[model samples]
Target: MSATTDGSRVRNLWDEAKAATLDEPGKLLYRSNLLGSDKRITNYGGGNTSAKVTHRDPLTGEDVTVLWVKGSGGDVGTIKLDGFATLYMDKLNRLRDIYRGPAHEDEMVGYLPHCTFNLNPRAASIDTPLHAYLPYPHVDHMHPDAVIAIAATRNGREITRRVYGEEIGWLEWRRPGFELGLELARFAAENPEAKGVVLGSHGLFTWGRTAEECYATTLAIINRAIEWFEGELKDKPAFGGEVVAALPRERRREIAARLMPEIRARIGRDEAKIGHFDDSDAVLQFVGSAALRPLAALGTSCPDHFLRTKIRPLVLDFDPANGDVEALVAGLDGAVEAYRQDYAAYYQRSKHPDSPAMRDPNAVIYLVPGVGMISFAKDKGTARVSAEFYVNAINVMRGASGVDDYLGLPEQEAFDIEYWLLEEAKLQRLPKPKPLAGRVALVTGGAGGIGQAIAARLMAEGACVVLADIDANALDATKADFAKGFGADQVRGTRMNVTSEAEVAASFAEAVVEYGGLDILVSNAGIASAAPVEDTTLEVWDRNISILATGYFLVSREAFRLFRRQKLGGSMIFISSKNGLAASAGASAYCTAKAAEIHLARCLALEGAEAGIRVNTVNPDAVLRGSKIWSGEWREQRAASSKIGTEELEAHYRNRSLLKRSVFPEDIAEAVYFFASDLSAKSTGNIVNVDAGNAISFTR
Candidate 1:
C-alpha cells in the first residue's frame, strides 16, 4: 500500500509510462482501454478519468489550466480523443463551488465550462469534481469490483478503516454531483494523508502525480483488495467465463462509437479514452446472467456516475438454460419494463416538491450469471466506466463478504441519492452540434477524372467547391457539369498547378473569403508515370511527388489554417492510386508517389482526427471511364503499350477485376461519400478502396 516501496523501480516504470503516453497518447489510450476491456473495470459509459494539461485562453490572453474528461457515456475502454471533453478548469471549479453554503443545489442553474473552440458540451460528469479534487496531475476513477466490493458492504466503513487505517476515507454513498463533491471535499479535509477513498456502496477514487502512477495505483489497490477478499470470503459457484480475446483497436473503436451516437448527439462530449478490461470469472458471471437476482444492487458507484453513466444500465434479463439470444433479448425487454416501473416508483418516492426526480438509473449493470457485464452510455466512456464500476464492485464484495452480501440501497436511500440536487445541477448545460458547416472545398486536380468526381461529390454534400486543374478547359467544362447537377453556388473553377504552393495558398485564401470558410480539402491531384524503378527519371519522380505528395501537404496546410481561423473542424480526402498498395511493372515513380500520398493521408488523418476534421484516402484501381487516364489519347497510348486495340485494353482491365466490371470514378465517388457522410463518423486513418474486386483484399 506504500507508493514509496521500490521507489526507483516504480519511478523508472512511471517514467516509461509517461514517455509512452506523451510520445504516443493515442496509442496509449487505445492500449489502456484494451487492457481494461474484458475485465469489466468499466462498462459502457460508467466512468471517466483524465490528465490535466496546461493551456492559455485565446480570448483572455491569460494562462489557464484545462482538463479533458471522458465524454458523456463514452466507453472508457474504447474512447479516443474525441471522447474527452476539454473544459477550462477554472470554470469547472466555479461550477462545483457556486451552490456551496446553504444554496439549494437546484436553486441556481450550474453553468459548465464550454468545450474548446466554443462548444457547449452538455452534462458535466457526476464525478467531475472528484476528478478535479485529486492532488495528482492525473486522476483515475473507476467502479472496480474490488473497490466496489469494499463499497457495497454494510461493514464498508469498518473494513476500510482496517485495511487502509484512515489513509483512505469513506463517503456515505450519495448520487454523484455537487453534493458528492461537497462530501468528498469534506472527506479529503478529514483525511489529510489519504491517497485513496471509498464511497460506501458506490466506488473508489485514486490519483497520482502522473498517469502511470494513477494507473498502477488503481491496479494495485484493486488487486490488493481482491487478494484480501479471496482470503477472507467464500468463493461462489463458478458461472460465466472470460473471453480473453483481444479485439483489434479499430474494431473496438468502431463498437464504442457505434454504441455512443445518441449520447454524443445529446452531450456534444467525446470520452477521448479507450480502456481494455481484464476478464475474470466474476465479471463474466455478472455480465452473463439472464436474470439479475435480487442479490444484485440497483445503484451506480455514486451519484456523480449518473453524469458519466446513465441512470442505470439496461439489466439484460437472460436465461442460461435457453441460450437462445432472441429469447434472452425478450427476457431483457421484460426486465427493462420492470426496471422502468421500479425506476418510476423510486423517482416518485424520492421526489421532493423542490427536487426533480431522475427518470432512470444513470446506468444499469446486468448481473448475468455467466456473461460479462456490458455498459451503455450515450457514449462509450460512460459505458466503460459503468462496467468498470460493476466489475470493481463485484470484486470488492467478493473480498468483503465471505457470504454473497452484495447490497442494493433501500428505496429511501436510493431516493436520496437519485434526487440529490448537486448532481442535477451538472446536467443543466446545453449541447450543440459540432460547428463545421459553411466550409468550402478547393480540390487540386479536381477536373476531368477522379478529382472531378470528388469535387462534384463535395459540392453536392454542402461544400461550395472550387475545382482546380492544370487543364483550364477541363476545369471550365467540369464547372458547368457541377452547376447543372448541384447549382452554381456549389461549384467554382480554377486553373493551377497542384505543385505550386503559392498558387495553392492563393486559391485557398480566395475560396475562404468567397465562401466564408475553407474547411474541407481534397488533395486529389497527381499525374501518373509508368516505368521500372531503375528507369524512373528524376523529372518523373519530382513531378510525380510534386503533384501528389507535396500537393497534399501544400493544399492541406492551407485548409487547416483556414479551419483554425474559422473555428471549424474540416474534412480532408486524398485520392491515392491502387498502385499505392502494390507495385506495377514500368511504374516506379507513380507507385512510389502514390504510396507516399497514402502515408501522407495517414499522417494527416492522425493529425486531423481530433480537429473535428477527417482525413482519409481512396485507392481506386483502373477507374478508366471519364477519367483523364481513360481519355482518348491516354487510352490509345495504353493500348499501344499492350499491343492491343484500345477497346481490348478496357475490356482486359474490366475483366481483370473480381467484380468483372470496369471501375469508374463513380465507384470511387460513392466510397468517398461514405467517408464524408455522418455514416463514417469514426472512420479516420483508414483507406477504403473502390476497385471493383481490387485484384485482392483492400487490407492485407
Candidate 2:
C-alpha cells in the first residue's frame, strides 16, 4: 500500500520506524491520527479507535489488561494522550452481568466511570462495550462515506457478501450500545475467519491482533468498498442525472447574497444564526438533480451525517432555466413556514414519552436548484461543518442510488438517536453562549490600532467580524492575528475603500454571503492633515473630507440597506475626533470633516429610528499611542502649533487636559464596544467622549 491514496485506494500512512519507538498506547494514538487524516476514511469526530494494553495496577502491582479508547466527544485526528479513557477489561466485561436488555442499556453508560483504571478522568463513550468485548487486541470503527454508501443500500448485505466474500460479515442496523457489543462478540466468535463487519445504515468495524495490522486492515476494507463502487457506479447516472444546469458562478453568488438574509431573518427569530454557502461541484450536482426532492425527503442514512445536517434539508422551489429570483423571494415566507410545520410534525410523530423537547424546527440544510446549498447554525464553524456533512450525505446518496436502491434509516430510529437521553446530557454540559454569540460586525479602517482593538473586543464577546480596509497587507496581518486568537471562522478580511460607493456595496454583499448578514457597522476609516488656512490645498482638503465624511456616509448607507433587508435591527458606531466639538488650530479641513461625521451620524440615527437601527459616535482627543493618524505630518503640525517639541507632544496634550492624562486607542474601542453592544440599547443619537477629561470636548 502506498503512503497516499487517491479516490481509488486508502492511503497507508503508518510508519513502522515511528511506531517502533512508542508503547502500545502511543501506537494507538498514532493509528487514530493516521486514519482520521483522510475524510474519505471518516468525518470529523465521527469515529473511534482502541487498543488493549497491559498495565501494572498502581495498587496491586500486577499486570492487567486495560482497554484504551477515544473518549466521549473527542475527535480522532486531533486527540492527545489525555483524550483516551482507560478501563480495566475485566471490569468492562463484568458489565454484561448487570445488563438488563436494550431498554436498560442506556443505564449502562452511568456505570462506565466505575470501571476506570488508574483513576483516569476522561469519560468513556457509549461504544465502550463494543471495543471491550471485541476479541482482538486492536479495533477500528469509522464512518467512511464509501463504506456507508454500501451499507445504506437496500441490498447492502448481499452486496457486502459479493464484495468482500466471507472475509467481512454484515449486521442489520442497531443503535450503538451494550446489546450491540454482545452481538458483535457473538459474530466474531461464530466466524473466526472474518476480518470485519459492515453495520447496516451505519459504518464499518475492523480489527487485528496488532496495531499495525489493524490500521492496514481498516484501510484495505474501505479501499475494497471504494473500488467496488467505482466499478459499479462507472456508467450510472448519479441522482437520476442532473435536471438543471448550474447557474454561472457569479450569478449563483448574487442569488445567494440576495436570499441568505431573507432566510436568516426567518430562521434566526429564536436564536441568531450564521450562514455558509457551498457551490462545490458535489453540492451543485446533487441540488440540481432530478432525484433531489425525493432523495432529500428520505433524509440522510448515517447517524453522524444526520445529526449535524438535521433529519432532512429544505428544497427550495427554484428553477435555474427561468432565473426567476424575485418569484422565489416572494414564495420564501410560505416555503420556510412549510418546512417548520413539517419538522414539527416529524417531532410529534417520533417523540417518546420521555424524549427531550424538540429543538429548533427550522431545517439546518437548504437546497437550492441551479445554485448550491446553504446551512445555518448558531456560529460560523457549525454552519460550515453542517454543510460539509451534507456533502458527505450527497456522496453517499450518489453511490447507493447508482448501484442499488438507497435506504434512509427509519424515521423512528433516527428520532431515537437524535433525541437520545445521553446526547441531551452532553448538550446540557456545553458552556453557556457568549454575550454577542451570533452577532456579526463590519469594521472599516480595521488595520488601524483603534479598529483592531474594537474588532478584538467584539470578537471576545463572540461576534464574527469582517475587517475591511484599503491596505491589503495590513488587513491580512490583522486578520491572521485575530484568527489565531479567535477561530478562523470568527473573522474574515476584505479589501474595501470606504469612499467608493461600489466598494462599500461589494463589501456589505460579501458580509451577507460570508456570515448571513450584518448586525453592526463601525465607520473608522480616516486621514488627518494639518495646514494653516492659506496653506491648505484642494487636494489636502478633498482627501480629508472624502475619507472622513464621505467614507462614513457610504458604509453607513450600505449597512442600513442590509439592516432593513434582514429586519433584525442594527447598531452603527462612528469614530469621530474631539475636534468635531472643540476647535483646533491649523487643521481647518480635518476639523470640518470630523465635525461632519458627527452630524451625519445624528442624521442617520433619526432616519433609522423606526427600523431599530441605532447610530452613535465616539469622540477621542490626542490619542497618540498606536494611532496611524498620529504617525505623520499631523503630529509635527500639532506640536508646532502648541509651541512644543515634536517629542513632547504627548506631555503637551496630557498637561492641557483637565485630568492630565493621555488617551489611547483602547479607550476609544471601549466606547465603541458599549455602543455596539446591547448595553447602549436605549441610548441612540448619543456621543461618548473618551478624551480623558478634556472638558472642552465633553458631549454636554
Off by over 4 Å in 1: 1-13, 17-103, 106-128, 131-140, 207-219, 234-292, 297-340, 351-404, 409-700
Cα lDDT tens digits, model 2, 295-329, are 99999999999989988999999988999999988
CA shift of 559, model 2, Å = 0.6
Q: Which pairs of residues clash in candidate 2, taking residues 3 or more apart in a chain or in different chains?
A: none
lDDT of each: 0.60, 0.92
Question: Judged by TM-score, which candidate is best?
Answer: 2
316 Cα displacement, candidate 2 (Å): 0.3
lDDT of 1 by residue, 1-700 (tens): 1122232122112346545645333433643464245343544455567777666678877877777666555667667677666777777666654565434544322444443423635345545666665545666677665667677777788888876776677778665556666676677667667877887866777766666666777666666666566565544432222223323433323322222222212122231111222235556554543223433544443444433434455545444444444565335435655766776766776678877745433234433333344443322233455555555455443454443455555566655655666545435543532222233567777886787777766655555677888888888888898888876656677777767888876665445323334545777776666655787789978888887788778887877665554344656778887789877666777778888988888887777766787888888887777777666555665567677897798788877788888887877777777776667778888888777776543667
| Error in Å for residue 615 of model 1 | 35
Runs with alpha carbons beyond 4 Å of true place in candidate 2: 1-4
lDDT of 2 at 514: 94
